[model samples]
Target: MPNYIALDWEQDQLFGIEADVNSGAVRLKRAFNLKWPDDVGTDPSARGQWLGTQLQEHRISASQALVTLPREDAVVRHLELPPCPADELSELVRFQAAIKSTRPIDELLLDYLPVEIADDEVAQSVLMTTVAREQSDSIRQTLESAGLTLASIGLTPVAAAELVVRVEEQQRLDETETSLVVWAHGDRVEISVIKRRSLLFTHSTRLTSTEDTSQHIQTILAEVSRSFVALQKLLPDVSIARGWIIAPNEEAETLAARLQERLSISTVSIPEISVRTIDPLNLSGSATVPIDVPGSHAPYVGPAGILMWASGGRAEFVDFLNPRRPAEVKDTRKLRAIVIAASVAVIIGGGLFWRQSEVAALEKAYLDAKSEQSSLEELQERAAGNVENVTAVQEWVDNRVDWLAKSHDLFNDMNGTERYYLTDLRMTLAGGSGAGNITGNGESKTYGEVITLYQDLGEHPERVVNTHEIPRGKDAEYPFRFELDINLQKPEPIEEPARDDAEDTKTETEEE
Candidate 1:
């Protein structure tokens, strides 16, 4: 199962679904919703963090996710061009879209799908889609922060168009037939025209909360009529024979009856949940939302349809964020020929050069080995001779500092005559370890003066490792008598490894 996450941005809520694209079937694993934040305007990271938490809670894991931007965030247009070269048609579409759009071309992310208008292979009709760069970039950055790459940035109406095609396919409708789809979402309604499996026209409008149900119905119908008229003018060759209403069952049935009476066309209400599902009750986040809802199941329809569109079930829409890069898709036929030709060349060249290089390398290595063998004894002698020199250098480097001078510097800063007096002092250096021990006794008139002698020695910790003091009972002047023990850091001894008998014999013979 190839699974993906689909995200939908609506006016009041953010909807997401995890589904598997198993061939033609799109199975919904879980669906989740998060309330749109009030601080979404100032702090954009709030949305990403919220979505990431929701995904974690639902355990929805996918490498990439598809997204549907709100209808108002994007611009969709159906463009028709006069006969021109296939390559130039895209440029023409861009020019037309730029002229009609209020924003500059560079300020928007644009893509298009060429709709097949006729079977004669000369028609140049296209569906041009554009979204504000800021809007697309904002959503893209948010998803990126959540560790999800935006595989496709689509629109609600475009997703609805895909659902319309899938619905027709499941119903086994004619391929050349045309139909009108009216999809009602929360606080918004989208009307689209799909002809021969290609989206022809799409329009979206905000639905106000009104007490009069009839007035609300009239507003939707009027918008539908307007869209229908516009579609006729745009594609005069095609006619929409039937219409489908996608909404809650009761509301859809009522709207369909009214729409049929007003437009004099057959209209039917399609179920809000259109896809074939293995389990309907286990559809919410963590498979917890019941199949039943208070009002209707209209909200789940849009998200499910968007998932179907992303899972290779629909083919008429273009993704702006992750559009197919024609340049990146190499012609495998030409690549295969080149690879084959290169293989033959490599085999021929390798067969000729391999044996020659191998023989030459082997001969060179043999000569180099023989030369190294001849110099081995000399190298060993030189290594043995350097050991004594290395040991001398190490001994001199470690004991270079004179401990007698360092100890002299320690007492030079002390005022023995005024502050304190040393009763007895002796310094001893341990054998070879280069460590010195100093034991001394000092007498002072007061205990404070006795502490001065200890402070003076502590000032030079580099020479005096540590010091201890013991006071003798006071007598007269210089009455406070203190005993001291001080240890001094010393130079480290040099260590040399034991020589083997063979090395000793070589050294002795060299000396001889």
Candidate 2:
């Protein structure tokens, strides 16, 4: 099995644990808990180069590592998800995380561990963990420079919880049995609840110090008590059966004794992975890590837990490299909008091109016409003798109404009507209108014969005829009387079709 490094960091410190991981075994080869080297810089390349130098100098050549986002930089929340199928649970958890998180989901890397999967369509509990993308990116850059391939990302509180479980080394706890695990370093403390080898709740609390002061111990105890109280609300049915704290031998025993005395909770302090009795480390190989190192093992707990998980001490761990996101659904609306926009663009582009062509054609034509224009002086000279007559004879003649043609038609109608002869008639033309009116009064020998003549006169297509009733003449000769006003228009000139020259000549010759 390949070896790896479990790494954890703070603002001014970097801790890495080199381990040879096998199936169900994690052999710690080295532990590096040191201050951050000066002026490593913020950018990835500069940081990576510095990290590579440190790794090379230390001779810790494990190429795989699991790193932690500091407790203060990561967030853990207990959430309830709607009942969903197994395949959809991940998608649901990610969507819920996005909604309940304070920061934008896109800015954070999120992962979730299903704590209790409900069987009867009830809301399920999940521990959702998140870290800022910027923080994880920095770690990634640093590790990449060291030629270390990142395996997973562990949050401080979660890694601490898993370490507590792995150190127990017994049958897994059932759902009802939970443990309260605490790890303190400097002024920060991580409190977590672990059940069934998985984390249920985790939180970070800052403290003044745990430097053998009665007041500091009391403060720590109070924080632990509050953690349990919060857990009651978080998981009302679960209770803490045991407590574990990571510290040195003397400090661990002291804190455990204080917990049992003040809070009446049977707590145990895990000093270190004792080399004499509990030897989990395979120190047989020629290793770079000092086997004779001294000091508190508190700092290594987070990184060691990560190594154990990589070595198959499995539990709910967050890997920011593979974060969760909402379900995959096709955006049909956006697709359709793009298609419609493209079609309209094509039409508008074609119209603009066509308009441009027309404008170009019109401009060329205008230039050509300008080149052909006659000089203004020559145009004025041509206009001198060409002045038009204001009252030309043809102007009067064209608009002249042919009253003779109208009279001929009226006379023909009256010629056949001997009984309906006209007693008086007159015709006059309206100036320049090419139309005239005829007014007449006539008596009829027969009453119906006078109307017959009026109807015949009105049958002409181009004229309008109107009749007025006159009192019947007392003369026994003509009993009915009528008056008519006929409005007449210009007569159309007839265009005779040309006769064949040969046919006309033949007819003349035959006649001769």
Candidate 3:
């Protein structure tokens, strides 16, 4: 048999149970109040740590679970939606929740179910409800960390109403009429109106004192009156038959009697609805009251109702299941296609780059081969003209050498004759031009002959050198020694034939 567990938290206690759905049987395996330190709420790890200890202490199993939100922080509103297709129901619920809840739509956990379908096909109505997102998330996190899967999250009134309806159905009681079920536990009161096994309205209010009980009853009666008025307005033709009250103890009956006496409505007290009990010891005392009224038995009502709902009893309204959310399967398929397309593009691009590189290398090799062929043809053409160029160069060199030798001979011949005596001689040649120098002996008679010799050599630009010397000294045999250098001109470089021209000449010679 499938097992479902219900978990409920008290300010100082934790209550839980597991139930067999097929047999409508329940077993309460764990119940305890933890003495957590005052700083537990302020410390990040304290709550989880304490909860772990409690779970270990109670030997609670990790399985399917359900939790009820605390009454103080939650606002349970039973709302109606215009007739629409079931597929569009979630959006309608969300829109209604946004309008009714103080919290934004993003901060709410909403659920809905169809209460009654109108005879008209085009338009139908639905019952929708919402709870705080934080409330649902906190319960889910606490149970999931303990290795439990949260099956649902709901309000205490919702759960209690489920159990009440189940008991009513067992008795075969017709629920076509409006009925009020009040369960008063300590300072809190949970009240609900059920019509035809479906919840039409549920509300909770704090009852602080027995003296103020009348005021609280009046307040509840006013709320119930408003709900009936609204339902009548929506279904103006439908009629409310009657009302009933559920209490764990007679306190609810007493309150209901007083309200009936004042309002003149029929009210009855029902027997205590048996639920899975965690601690039979705790169940002792005044906790065993009628199922409709809450005394000390109020804490168990939430868990008991949750188990009843899990055990095949129809839920009056949906809790957390929504079939309208976008489909994850479709999203997965789209993402896979995108990744495949991107991979194919990358592979194709890589192949193109590789082919381009090969083409560039082949083009470079062709250009280099053409350049080398041109160079060979130019060299062949220069070789064909080599004989005439060499002959001209040799002739020029021979003429220059002969001229230089004759100049040297002329100088030696003059020295032998002693027309002028030379003391120092220097010469240098650069850039195909040259100069020389001579120092005259300290004889006034030889001075005129030296000047004449210098003039004659200076006239020949190829061998004549510029001359300079120190001034002549009286009584000195040689006045001064000379130092000089010659500046020479550079010969022009020979030109090579063009590649195209050399190729053409070779082709013509072959033809001849």
lDDT of 1 by residue, 317-413 (tens): 7678754333444569988989998999899889779988998999999989988987997788888779888887887775565657855775685
In candidate 3, what are the lDDT values of residues 1-512, reduced to their tens digit?
A: 66666766555455565554454444444333345456666332456566666666767654777776545555555555566665576677678878877778888777765555233435445556666677666666666666677787766766766766665555566665445566665566666656666665556666556656566566656655654465556555444343445443434555556545533432221222221212111232212222232124445677766666665655574466432342243557778888889888888888888888888888888888889888988887887678678876775664343336644754664555544444544333323332223222323235555565556555544444455653555545544333332232233356886579778899999999
My TM-score estimates for the predictions, one after another, are 0.57, 0.56, 0.50
Descending-TM-score candidate ranking: 1, 2, 3
Candidate closer to the true structure by lDDT (higher is better), 2 or 3? 2
Report, for every candidate in turn, its global Cα lDDT versus the true structure. Answer: 0.68, 0.70, 0.55
Off by over 4 Å in 3: 2-4, 10-13, 23-37, 42-45, 70-72, 76-80, 98-102, 117-123, 209-244, 248-250, 259-295, 321-512
Candidate 1: list runs displaced more than 4 Å: 40-42, 58-63, 85-88, 98-100, 120-123, 265-295, 324-512
Lowest lDDT block of 10, candidate 1:
272-281
**Model 3 lowest lDDT segment of ten:** 272-281
- Deviation from truth (RMSD, Å), model 2: 23.4
Reference-based TM-score, model 1: 0.57
| TM-score leader | 1
Quote the positional error of residue 10 for candidate 3 in Å. 5.4
